[model samples]
Structure formats: C-alpha cells, structure tokens
Target: MQLVVKPVPDTASNQCLTESCAWHGFDTNPPFEDIVELHYTGYHEKKKFASSREDLGEPLRTEIGTGKVIKGWDEGIVSMFEGEIARLVIRDDFAYGAYGYPPMIPGGATLTYEIELLRIEKPTSNHKLKPSH
Candidate 1:
C-alpha cells in the first residue's frame, strides 16, 4: 500500500531546512537519549475497526521507552519532550496495515494521533529521580 505523507506545517511553508525539522524545534526539548514518559490523547481513524468488539475511542496510554508497542509510538515519542504537545499524522506504513488489528486498524489506512508529553525520566544508578537532561 502507498503511504500518503502529510506535510508538517513548518515544512510545508518552507520555513525551515530539512536537516533541521521545524517540528523538532518546538518548545519540546527532551534529550535524545532520555526515556520519554508521556500521556497522549488522540484517536485512530481507519475505514474499519481493528477489533470487532472494541470501540475506536479507546485511548492509548503508551510507555514508549520499553519498546512494547507499535513503530509509530517508538519513533514519535522520542521526538517529544516533557509538556510538549504534538499532532502526529501517521501513515498506514507506520501503523497496523493490510491485515489490521486482527480484524481496528484496516489495511492501507491512515491514522492521526494528538500526543502530549507529560513527563520525562532519566535512568539513574542511584535510587533518586535524576533531573531531566
């Protein structure tokens, strides 16, 4: 399936260079290596449902650092910082495609997620919550 690329606003207006993404330059400034803990509020849109029983409104509370989820969460979460809010426009390639969610995400479907980075935590050898880098 062909993935439709939704142009980010800054990039679409030619306001920034490709090497430096305008989206990356937002208020969010978490370190690249820091593990991002976030609370995202968004919805998934597809032609059909991923699950026959589950509704589409089921919000996803993902702990991104553990690599326990989809590729979009893995990549998108790292690009945000504590308290940063982003409107993520995801393509089918980044989400469950072709054979969707066993039955919510459908094949060749696109999804959008409005994400908010609520917290950032640093891993420390000591038993203290290390300051965000």
Candidate 2:
C-alpha cells in the first residue's frame, strides 16, 4: 500500500506539504481538536463504494484528533482551512488496514477520497463562571 498527495493548482499558494500529507485551499485554519463538517467520497480500485454526500443525510461531523475518523484523515486534515477541498490517497495502514472495513471495503485496499471542508467549529474557550448570588 502506498500514499501520495497531489496539490491542487489554484490552491498551491495555501498548500502545506509534509512527509505524509499535503493540504490546500484558503479559509480559517482548523486545529486538530476542532470539530469539522465535511463531504467525502470513498473509493477502492477506482470504483465508488460509499459517499457521505450520497449515503449520509448530513455532512460528516467529527472531531479531528480524537480518532473519530481514520488515521490518515487525522494526519492529513490538520491545519486545513474551512472550504478547502483536497484529494487524499491513503494506504491501508493509515486507513482500514489489511482487514479493511468489512463488505463495503475489501482487504488491503488503497482508498482515495475527495474531502471537502465545509465548516469548522473551534473548541470553545474555557472560562470560569462567576458565583451566583
């Protein structure tokens, strides 16, 4: 299994490259702990299997760094801006692994997803409340 990141041409200016992942587009930066809304299509061997846009009624909402999603998504989407759309080619190791995710995804699959960042809800500020009379 192999993973590769291809930066979008127009979003190159906002592109941030790392050893394992790359992100593009422009908007507010989303921290690892932030809850994000996204639309994604999942594929295996160039065939559409599942899509948040089609199967799910609403956009996928999850916390970034809490393992709510795949490892690749957590690593790849960090610091990504809201409204950014990027292609993520994730290896089995970073994804569902050799066992895969059961019937929907076969074993040892190399998954490709077109992830669109729809919105980001930052962690609310922690402030102590005053005592009531």
Candidate 3:
C-alpha cells in the first residue's frame, strides 16, 4: 500500500534529528554493514484512532542488531555509521501495522525517531543463526 508521504524540511530544524544531520538530504555513498548502536531523540505518532496509545518521547536510546529490530529501525539505521545520527520518519506500514497495542503503541502508527549511531560491532560467527529444521 502506498502511503501519503510528508516532505521533511530541507533545512535542519529543531524538529529534526540533530544539528549536524542531513535531515532530508540523500546519501551519495552508502556505508558498510556492521552492528550500529545509536542514541535516538524523536517522537512516535499513533496513526489509528486509538486513544489508548501514548506518544513516545524524544531522546530515546535504542540498540539495532541485524534482523533483531523493527523494519524501519533496521533500514533506517543501516545508512548510519558510528557516532552518526539521523531522524527517521517512519510510516505505519514500516511500524506496527493493524494490530494496535494498548496504552502505548497503536495500529497504523507513523513515528519519527532521531537516531544516533553509537557503535558498530562487526558480525562474528559466534552470533550467526543456526538453521532450523
């Protein structure tokens, strides 16, 4: 399903991730893959009309491991390197879908997370997933 995307401001504002982030700028060169730890500061908006869910606050700290986080987080953080931060404007489809959570997150929630890449731990065989029969 195609979502109506809102254009993030070209100039970095207080409403954006951090002072140094390229808020709406595109990456000309992509970074290598590894573990990236970040310190995010942003808000989470609930799309659906569920009054139970609350708006998540800013400056939220999160850890992103390969395939261990939500799709938005996975895709959003991959472009960043250690000490790099960015504001991730996530659509509901990229977030929690139809199933709404009570008193926290709602269905079809669109959120914006200001993320910082704290560290990147290279993938090792010790952390590889074993095949399931």
Candidate 4:
C-alpha cells in the first residue's frame, strides 16, 4: 500500500580510499619491501603539483609499504603490477595532512596521482631499471 526509498550513498567516496582508490594492472603485484621504480605525476586540486618526468633520467624509486613515502602512495601503489598505469585518488589523511606541504599542497587537500609502475626489483634480484618512455 505504501512505498518508500532511501537515496544511496556514493560508495566510492574518499571515506574508503584504501579500497576505493582506482587501479589498473596487467601483471602480478609485487610484494612489500621490493624496490619499485615508477613514473608519476601528482596533482592538487586539478593542477599539476609535481612529476617524476621533471627530474629526468630518474624516476621515483621507493620500497612499497615502507614509510619513505606518504601513506597514500604506499597503500595505493601496492595493488599495482609492473608496467601498470593508474590514477590513485588519495585522501588528505593519507597525504600531507592538516599541516600540508608549504607553498604547495594545502591543508586537508585531496590529491590525485597518475602513476606508471615501471619495474619491481625483489631483494634477490640485482636487476636495474630502465628509463620510462
């Protein structure tokens, strides 16, 4: 006799960034502590903040799950496989946070990063990474 419907909440909201961050991968994901070399462009509020290409001859290098990078990067990149390119939508809590990076990122800013996982070097491998094209 009566019908009522409630509006659905957006499940992809930043509240679930760890699970909601977008990623596309073709190969297998590397394990934690493995050295991963990647090329990435960071954007803040739709404006380009930084890019690995800006460094030239050197892409960003870091160990996944390590504390060397922002929490977002560690969490976002872990799901990626070698040669996978993706956009990682990172919440402010996972980024520079309230203080933010001076003269660049602002407080409570949600950042997006377009990254390409170029190579993964496990501890046992002495392989070198080639420049990204």
Candidate 5:
C-alpha cells in the first residue's frame, strides 16, 4: 500500500497572526474586568465554520482579556469599542494550530472572524472576574 501526503497552506504567513487593531476612542476604554456582548462569524479557507443564527441565537457574552476563548479572540476584542465592526485574522499558533479543531478547522488553518461589538459593560457580580497575574 502507498501512503498519501497533503500540504497545508499557511495563507501567506497567516497575515501577521492577530493583526494590529486600531483603537476607536479613549472615551470608552476597555477595563480589565469588562464584559462584552458581541456577534461573530468564523471562517477558514473562506468557508463559514462557526456562527449562531441571527434570529434564534443570543450574542456571545464574555469577559475581556480572559482565556475563556482562543488567544486571538481575547486580544482582538480588547482593542474594539462598543458598536465597532472589524475583522480578526489569526494564525495557527493563536488559533487551533497543528492539531486543528477536529473535522471543522484543518491543521495549519488560518481563521478569520467578522465581528461586531454590541456593548461594553461593567462586570456584574455574577461574573467571576479575576485579575491577570
């Protein structure tokens, strides 16, 4: 039997990982314990991989600078302002990397997220906010 091999494309060095996000304004600066509501659609190889239905699903709510999500997402969201829309381009190291995310994200895949920041809110007591050491 013969073995087959496939090459993984790096998407042109993955566009500098998380990219340099532009700060919208300082009037509404992001706090360490700030919570955010946002909508996003993820894509790899220019095909949609993840997202919720616009009519049925609620926006994702999470704390900023937390590792709850991927590294790229956390960093990208930190630079955004309320009601701002932007795209985040992330490389494998910041994304799923060599192992990838099962059947969805392939190995060495570069992920892109079209995101909209709904709101930046003060952390409610219910949220577990821990200072990053």
Candidate 6:
C-alpha cells in the first residue's frame, strides 16, 4: 500500500508518519495527551469494518502514546485538535500484524480510518493515568 503525508500550507501541522503509515491533521494548542474522546470509521479492503459514530453510543476514549489502541491510531491521533478530522492509513506491522484480530481483521491487511477528534482532557492533578492494556 502507498503512504503519503505533507505539510498543509502555512499550518504548523505536519504528517505524522510516511513509511509504514501516514496521517494528515492539524495541531492543537495543548496537543493530544493524557486522554481523549473521539469518533472513527475503520475500513479494511475499502469495506467499512467498524466505527464509533454518534449512533454507536459513546465516543471511544483512550490515552495517547500508550498501547491502549492499535499502534497506527496512537501515531496518527497525536497533535490533532478537537473537531479536526484526518485520514490515517496503516500497514500490517503497525496494525494487528500477521496474527490479525480474529474475524474483524485479516493477516497482513492494510487498514484505513477516518478519525475525528471530539475532545481533549488533560489530567486534573499531577497524578498520571495508568495505561490500559
């Protein structure tokens, strides 16, 4: 699969990855961190596989730079501002890899996602939130 990322004009934002994956989006003031809530549409082989839209109940929440979600998502979601949307394309190595994720994902498959940043929440105190496994 092909991966591409480039600067978006005068915006300080830039592509996150360009080898195994690619992402294009804007940067937030505080940057994506400790925790975030967002919506996403996941696609495999150009077919809709999963999503976290409004109709799908609560928006998904996760900690950044943590292995809580797929590697591709971690690399792509950072630095994105709330209300910003972007496309993240990832190869197998950054996704579920050769073993895949059961029936939802296949071995060595390339996946794409249309992710929208809904909110960013920083920790209230100095205590850090533990990364969910």
| Range of the 10 consecutive residues with the lowest summed lDDT in candidate 6 | 12-21
Better of 4 and 6 by lDDT: 4
For residues 37-129, what per-residue lDDT tens digits would candidate 2 score against the true structure?
A: 888887788898878878886688777866768777777677456876777777777778788888888777778877788888876676222
Of the two candidates 4 and 6, the one with more favorable TM-score, higher being better, is 4
User: Model 3, poorest ten-residue lDDT window?
Assistant: 50-59
Lowest-lDDT window of 10 residues in candidate 4? 1-10
Give the poorly placed runs of model 4, Cα more than 4 Å off: 1-25, 124-133
Kindly give the number of clashing pairs for every candidate: 5, 0, 4, 0, 0, 0
Point out where model 1 deviates above 4 Å.
Answer: 1-34, 46-66, 124-133
Model 4 lDDT vs. the true structure?
A: 0.69
Model 2 scores a C-alpha lDDT of 0.67
TM per candidate: 0.52, 0.73, 0.54, 0.74, 0.72, 0.71
- Candidate 5 lDDT, 1-133, residue by residue in tens: 2222212224443444554233232345456558877788889989988884453287777777667677677666666667756678888877788989889899988898776777888887777743320
> What TM-score number comes out for model 5?
0.72
Ranking by TM-score: 4, 2, 5, 6, 3, 1
* Clash-forming residue pairs, model 3: 35-120, 37-118, 38-116, 41-59
- Give me candidate 6's TM-score against the actual structure: 0.71
**Would you give me the overall lDDT of model 3?**
0.47
Least accurate stretch of 10 residues (summed lDDT) in model 2?
Answer: 13-22
What's the CA RMSD for each of the models? 9.5, 9.6, 10.3, 9.0, 10.8, 6.3
Residue-wise lDDT of candidate 4 within 1-133, one digit each (tens)? 1222212124443352533223444667767777888888888989998888895556877777666678777766776778767677778888888988878899998888877888887765664433221
Please give the lDDT score at residue 96 for candidate 1.
Answer: 64
Candidate 3 — which residues are off by over 4 angstroms? Answer: 1-33, 46-65, 128-133
Clashing residue pairs in candidate 6 (N, C-alpha, C atoms within 3 angstroms) = none
Candidate 4: deviation at residue 19, Å?
8.1
